[model samples]
Target: MSAATTAAGAATADEELRWLADGRRIEAIEAISVSAMARRLPALVVRAFRLGWRIDRGAVGLLLTCQAVSAVLGAAGLFATTGTISALFGPGRVEDKLAHAAPSILVIAAAAGARSLLGITIRTVTIHLSPRISRAAEAEVLRATVAAELTAYDHAGYNDELEAADRGAEVCVDIVGEAQNLLASLASLLGAAGVLTVLHPALLPLLVIAALPQGIASVHAARVQFLANRATIGDRRIMANLRWYIHVKRNADQVRSDTMGEFLLAKYDQVGRRLDASSRRAAMQSARVSVIGAAASGLGGAVVWAAMLWLVSTGRMSLPRGGAAVFALTAVGTSLRGIVGYGADLFRTGMYLDDWSSFLDTAGGHRLERGTETPGAPRRIAVENLGYAYPASDRKVLDGVNLHVERGEILALVGENGSGKTTLAKLLAGLYLPDAGTVRWDGRDTRDLDPHALWRQVAVAPQDYARWPLTCRENITLGQPTAEGDAAVLRAADASGAADVVARLRRGLSTLLAVEWMGGEELSGGQWQRLAIARAFHREAGLLVLDEPTAALDPRAEHRIFQNLRAVARERAVVLVTHRLTNVAVADRIVVLEDGKVLQEGTFAELVAEEGGRFRELWDLQNERTGVPARRTRQDQRTVPDQRTRKDQRTLPVREDEGSGR
Candidate 1:
């Protein structure tokens, strides 16, 4: 097997074992005991009921009334049946017995019919309420996920918990049915038990004994299945991700170009096989337990029947009472089985709901809890002794970084990859909180400001901006349109050079940006980047962070963007991060960073004139690559000879030769 497959399999096995251990702990708590189930049953029922009540209170009330009425009718039907049996068995003329049993027969029919109607009503209410409950649960999960801090995504534990909560949301609807089933079963059990007690007290205990073995088997089987499902969670997630990669239109071209279809399918198959193996093992174990329990149940059933025979054979119980006992015993047994089955199902679903509830309460333990102070658009954003390290990482992405940008100033951050340029810009924009020091907006710390309110004043055109599958207008406005509306969108589009792109669209501003939908169209990489830039331009924000804002643009569009940037920055503090040193000329000040620390800070002319500096070295190298003469101060122009040829300029060394004053 390939290393990827081998590693996946190993990780899956380890997770499966861990989940199995958790299942064992649950099993210990829920072992076949009346006290255990009784303790758990009330809480699970109340939780389900609370959810149902929240969704549709009328339906919840109707469901409860129907179950209660159905149980009463069931008990009434059994009593009428007993009366009919007693009349028929009495020592009397056949015609007389038939006449005496007539009313009892009608009563039984009425009770059965009423119970059937109640059952239908119960079903209707459940159907009406289940979907609403499911949607509400899913909505709550989405809200919690959205409310969580951005840094929450950096931790694997948070993601795993999120997946579990999502799964819980899906199964949340099942708890409604399970809770109702359990209630109905309990009602039936009580009515039957009561009837059996009236018939003869001995029969109730005997019926329970006969049903106990099967009840235990059902609970054990459910636990096995739950454990199996828990074990396969990681494998299932892997399959889902792999399937998306293999099936999505975005990856379709690459899958075919790289001949990756078979490789992806093989990994999928590997994960599927592991899941199948666990399921099969669990099924086999459940079957073994079930077979043993069935045998024990059969023996217990025979003992109950023998006891009934003894009661009848002795003059202790009448034939009519014995016949009623038979009916009551069957009812009790059915109810007991229903209770065990539904209770097990309810418990399983409750565990899933617990995950959902826990996530909502803690948002995977990463809920945002910033201050209530909502600051207005910042006049000056400052970073003082800023330091940051990503969750679970020892290496700092930014450390001791101090910079400031005021309104109307364009500060350019230039750095190589992993040199913390983007991280520094994000800190300036209040996207992340520094661990060591403060990022302040107009004198107020960002940490002391409401995150949502703070973010409203910050606009970002990131390197990897989203290609939102929305209308062109919506994409530009980001669903938060200003009072100017389409006019604002158009102006921003024009500024970002996306006006021409929008004009070519079938619906102009109304055109959907995804091809998967009807009447929608896809944009080229450069076109998409323009829309991204337009979104940033459209936002009326105090701070603007543009990271590689023109990476995908053509030379003309790139030049246009930088040429107009200073004008755009007149009302906001613009922090631009780019590797293209040529673009830094647009900024009032340039800060060159290397290894998370400032290497140089100056104007484009000053940095380029400082010979042997990192910025000067980089500037010369870029000039060499493009066969352009390096920017020089008037003093340097006088000291160095002009290169004679384009070829010589292209081959110019980064370092000037000392003592060779050409």
Candidate 2:
């Protein structure tokens, strides 16, 4: 209703757009928003009560005091009117009654004008500050999200938590703005109550009693909605996913390929139908709450109205007082109903703020602590009896697995697609911690080491590269910062063999990744993979772990990259996880994995020399698949075999004794 209230909702959509840019379900939003609101509630309430003081607290107080004085003057003017009527027939009224009444009426008019101006000025201030609140709240969401550990996102409830947090952040402005309006309404209700008290004190208690049931119902309705939001959070996400499947560009190919475009459409329709049904049910319940509350308030007003007419008939009250009494009761009754409605609105919004606060409370465990020591020398990363269970899974992916990498040496970790090679790499890089045993950096446990600090010295080309929507420049720069311009980016691009891809873009390095916003063409998977390799190269960390890094490249391009890797490895320990033995032939040492442990380790010559090892088996399979001979000679392996010695994987044991988290 006021300018201040209007401002809170105006810039909200833009603020939410910035939020949506993070991801489909923003993990950081809740910690940022609701937590701060919960902390600020007391202050907000205090501000609400003193809200009218914005133009000048003293000036507003002076204005209100004058209005009170003017109302008293108007009551005196009423007495003047009554006396002037009786005096027309006899000497019942005071002299100059009309002239005295005129000044009282004029003072009332002047006070009313001052109050209007104060209201407008206060409204303007509120409108101006609304964006500040929204942005501040939104900033908190971003801070908490980015600050959280990557692994915390593995949980399913986090998906719901994230959406709820955004909802809370979006609705918080409405809550506070409406709260201010509610307070103003409360003031009017107070004035109306005082007027009613003067007219008939007997009806005052009855009106309050009549309002209680509705007030309770309003609060109950708010709780119901909050619970519904909590319950349907899963359904809402499913609906969103289905809706995207049927409409979003990314899912279009799959939906059509299965020719279940209509089936996907039907699923979307089903989810939509359920959502509609739920919303309608909630609306009906809310309407019932409102209706019952309204009836009670109307009854209270009717009681007061009936009493006034009776009092007038009994010659105990004047007609003018009776009319004033009617206005007072009706206004007070409506205000009662409004107060209940506003209270419900506030209650629901309070939960949103609660959701925000609760999310923030969870931020500390996820973000890296600032004071952790950075590793002095990049050392061998060892997985000792390492075992992992997926979040909420009963079975282990990497059970009692032992693996080791020495400093400045390449270790080729090989396994079948689902045999946990990538998972082991993630554990080694500190993206994930083993459920049991240790992934130690030099003899120091990874849990004791700060992940952020470790990440500074480690670069990983994950199974999937993060395809940032920013320009190719921003995308690569995200892996590292400080350098800018096409020249710096081109160098990194060239190193990762992505320079040609960048050269083909319309704006080259400056072109945006997405086709929707900035006018730039998109790259294919192979091209994006090259960009990812450039990003990893740009990181320039002491430890480089590439998972299937050469999957998208041709044999010739792959060979060229392997040459680049040998030069890069002089300063850093390189771990290549790949199925292509032909590509891994360039590694300084090769570690072959079967199930989750190392089956054998040696130089390519030595491992190939062993007649019965897993490396030889894979080599033969690749040779057969590629139409090349991987024929091995016993004399070729003789001296190399003498140089290599290894241990069994069966001796590794599991351990999980540690504090959960602070």
lDDT of 1 at 237: 80
TM-score between model 2 and native = 0.78
Best by lDDT: 1
Q: What tens-digit string does per-residue lDDT give for candidate 1 at 239-278?
A: 8889999999889999999999999999889888998999
The local distance difference test score of model 1 is 0.86
Model 1 bad stretches (over 4 Å): 1-34, 626-662
Q: Estimate each model's TM-score.
A: 0.89, 0.78
lDDT by residue (101-188, candidate 2, tens digit) is: 4554555466556556656654665565555555556667677787676777775466667776777666655654566556555655
**lDDT (Cα) of model 2:** 0.68
Candidate 2 weakest ten by summed lDDT: 16-25
User: Which candidate leads the pack in TM-score?
Assistant: 1
lDDT of each: 0.86, 0.68
